[model samples]
Target: MELSKIIPVSKPVCRSSYPDNPHSLCRRFDPPLLVCFSCKGQHLENRRYYYYCATCDLEFHRGCHLFPPEIKHPFHLLHPLTLIFLDPDFQSSRIPIDWPDSSSESDDYDSYEENPGSYEGHIVKCNYCRKYLQPEEFGMAYYHCSTCNFSLHRICAYIRPPLAIENLKCHDHTLTLFPRRVPLPCDACGFSLDTPFFDHVYSCLLCNYMVHRTCIYLPRVIKITRHPHCLSYTSSIVPSCELACGVCRKTVDVNYGSYSCTKGCRYALHSKCATNKKVWDGKDLEGVPEEEEEILEPFLWIDEETIQHFSHDHHHLKLRQDGGSHENKFCEACTLPMTVSDRFYSCIKCEFVLHETCASLPRRKHHPVHKHPLTLFHPSSSNPHKVERKYYRDGFFTCDGCTRNCCGFIYRCSEQDCEFQLDVRCASLPDPSIHDCHPPDHPLFFNFTSGSVMTHHLHFFIQPHHFQLLLHHLHLLPHHLHLL
Candidate 1:
């Protein structure tokens, strides 16, 4: 019979035991030569239909197993969603955008459930092509509305955008689609509602302007990592100087919306701080194509002060003045805790170290608490699940600067409404502090890095006005620091 000579006598649809083979059973490779978690594409190169779980090495994709473990959608008909695949970043769900489109169901939808794939930070997006659903598209997934715990992006729950948005671009009229989802603030970019969904913006019943589909075109001229010039976009400015914000140095509200620097220079930047997701990379580079400049990797010394570290291969890192590791150590590059009086930069023979100011960091800087520039995320952890979220290794999230609750290497808040955090134990403080504390070895200067928990509380010694004297409030603690 011509059923491909009897479909090769089908069999192997499910057998399992995988987390790398806990003792064999394998099978199920079905016909997916590699690339299917559900339409991330890959029909044949070896033919694979997927389903392998293998305890958790996971695979699945018979169209993500014919979907529908429970979905309902009308943009969130108030719960009935539960399909889940993992990687909503911290995936406790929450995505459908502001939710509450109601249709009934609330009580947390009887505890949802489906998760289990093993989390790992992929960043999800795609409330309908806001892009980033990638991680090989999580094997055709992205749902979870489950009564408003929120979720959706296995292709925006199966495609649906387009109610109105024509002509748009500095507009001559025609721009509808703000009908719901509020949080305003983007008459071109005063930044409110950084969008993942909330309809991403595009209004104007007739006047006020409202752009942002990533700020409708806007870029009379750009270029920003924190400026070298090129900014341009000036619709208005009164600045006699000090416009602030070369990158979150704050104080840039000249009425609203700005970019400044077509040579009038003095440098500015905030239309949401020049669209920062770590300072613009969402692109609209306008013309694009000449790029290719960032080379810089030099300072890697071993002479004037030791170097050599492609992440410690064999040995040769040098610089551990008091490096660390009598045991409780840690900072192999932001793992946190390494206080032996801190100064770091080791590798004399084994324990491998660094924190001699994290061996020079500043592949980018900024940080007056967050408007953009802390960007180094992933300074280490080649694996072991990186920082491991959903509350791994404890700590989870907290520490806009010692408000407490610690994990490691966050430094986030590239705007987009995301709050702000620090946690690398206050990103490795020691600013002007040089051991021995008050008096004696003198240097103590830490300035309370933007504390929280009350009116204010960061004072890391703060009294070296060149040493005018005041030394009392020092509340420091990554491992130790007295004098409060």
Candidate 2:
């Protein structure tokens, strides 16, 4: 008999117990035809072999049976990892491990006090991918070490990255995988020495170039919405004066890695802040040619004082330095009541109106809070029925930045599936902003570390000029306002 025929005739004992049957024997199927009970799909379009149960009509991939009872993963070798199935239902009877009853209040308090770091009580995530293990119907099987409470997905267990990496972009010498977490500063990004590990750390003993796994692949050159020119990743920035981040308006430590302007400008951003998913577009523009800048005009000039605005194109708006005085009339862009001392644009034929600042807003611009370029969008101007169902469900959308619901013109992200929207007020504030209320020389900058507006010598809100200005400052400024 052929070996293929003989192998199919053999039956294997399945570790998984079937309902009412303590011992379930599985038979090999030469050509898999049914969906796998664990994975919920065929292995390879009926090409691979699998184990099937005739009584329950359930199927399992051949690899599922081949899983060893325990494994000694190279990354975590202090203790052996055991194979276990994590149930998704949250009420499964097959608990991975049983804990002694912590009903005694003193025992719980004593255990927590001894090791507070281990009792974070966060949801279990895969040690490899750092993703929450949301198991599917039949429960997701993975390798677990109960002693350390470390777990890895089934796929990550079998597929391991090389132990040693050479010719890495961030480092010069051959970097060996450090296997476990170490309290050492990463040379690429200034983290993990004082702070917790961002991911796995790779180390070069020869050059002392220790770096995080994720930081090894940091883009050499990239463009962010915060700056005008492209920025290149730099190991350090030696400035005569203290350097503040252009994005968060926080101080940039010169000793650490950061992204600096390529045009020799006095602008720099923290490595972590520059690569924030909401800040960078995630494209590596190392050798790519820069495209010609697109025109960002909000309207075409019909005349010097009159123009056809993009949002309210149905009528020509006439610019007015002073809008006289109106009680009921409101600026259509900001949804604020028109004031006598406001510079605004009024529609030539209709009640449509806009603030001068609002009308001059470009068709597309980048807000500091979002990664993608935001387009000037009018909820009422789009498809009336479509907008009604999508945005006007409650007659207003909650602004992602400020969390205030407003019925006004919004700067919405252009990317599909991204619903990030910013109200006119929050979108207009410039980073490292200078306000006319203070002085021209003193620019107000926000300090992310101290969580305060660093005015240096100027006093902000010492005496309020108006209630509206005070309200705006109170709403945006953080709790601890440092005068310095």
Candidate 3:
């Protein structure tokens, strides 16, 4: 018979037997096919079979079969292969396999009549890193190397499967592979993991925290009262303070973590402050009503040509056109040197004048810790019990927000119901502020008489003059509310 049509048979090959059932043969339309030792066979698909080697075309469905055994592989000239009966010792038996040189045509089986000795002892290679390893390194159906820490199962090495499942535990939404780097922070800890880390992420819409796919299962509701709304990870940038952070008390750049507002106030909280438990008492106080409406007045009257600022004790303060001359002038607020340009207050009579920085001090402010708002006082009233009074004797007011003494200017409130106050510098602060400038949408509003008093801290009261100045700078003309 011709070798191609012979249908090579094994010596007493094993097979699974089924009870005389007519439907068994009919059900085997697509029979389980197997190849073993240069021979192939077709068996019933439902049978319990084993030992079908795809490399040699030999089939063995039952356990009782034994066939002629070959001790050596015809293709391998140097190394002899062996059959494994049980768990083989990989540490001692592992060996590397070499590929035939690309230039050697003699290794091609079709061209050469004899065995090419090229397919005898081949080892599997890792698909990801492309490193080859010995068969002994793979003990079971699949295995991995402990030394290099490279790993893959037999099916895993050949298959390119998706890395993530549809519903993972870390997040509420399905996680997809993040093949590219994201510009925002992580949804979990708010850390910037845009570097080399490979994983999935879930983003929240309420705060700056970006959670990784694994961190999505973490609790969503954190009990932080510093913010009026519950904090969540969001993509929005928040309004920040001009000075250091109010909570961590650390100076941070604006690009870091930000808190979100639920009231649509366009306000953002610092990450630390967002998680704080202190609640803010929501109270909006209107300015005190005047018995007879006083005509609104400008804080200072100036001529078109030049304006001079004079102190009661000073002879005269002449205005200078050069801003560089006032570069080193002192600010009335913190008593720091004024480095800003454009204007200054001078008394020509006593040759004494306040810089533009001193003249810009705020008259009122509200603090988180204070119950009532504080006001700015011209030659601020004496508070003998308070340490700030010592500095107040020199016509300076202490900032109720920070409790620090200031000389540039001061603010105060007259109503005994509201105690809130601020130094000139603190009171002039703008809402929804960024550095020195305030956003236009949320213009500053001033309250002089019944200055708004926060309910949480009744002792703190809003100052009117500072609020009025801030409004004036915004170019908002006062109607009923008069400047103090």
Highest TM-score, which number? 2
Q: What is candidate 2's lDDT per residue for 265-362, written digit by digit as tens?
A: 89898888888776788999999876755977988899889999888889899998766654468777667776677777888898888878778778
Scored by lDDT, model 3 comes in at 0.37
Cα-based TM-score, every candidate: 0.24, 0.64, 0.27
Error of 2 at 430 (Å): 3.6
lDDT of 1 by residue, 1-484 (tens): 1212222322223223332534221335454435434333333322232345455454533334334356566556556766665533322322222222121212232233233343455455544335654433334356765344566665556544455667633567777655234466676566664455434566777677666665665665666644544566654468576575654445776755688866576767677667655566455444554354564341367686677655564567666556344337666545555666677667778776656655555444544334355544542433554444433344355555555454444555444545555654455454444433344344443322323211112223332221211221343432322212
Return whichever of 1 and 2 wins on lDDT. 2
Deviation in angstroms for 165 in model 1?
13
lDDT score for residue 406 of model 1? 49
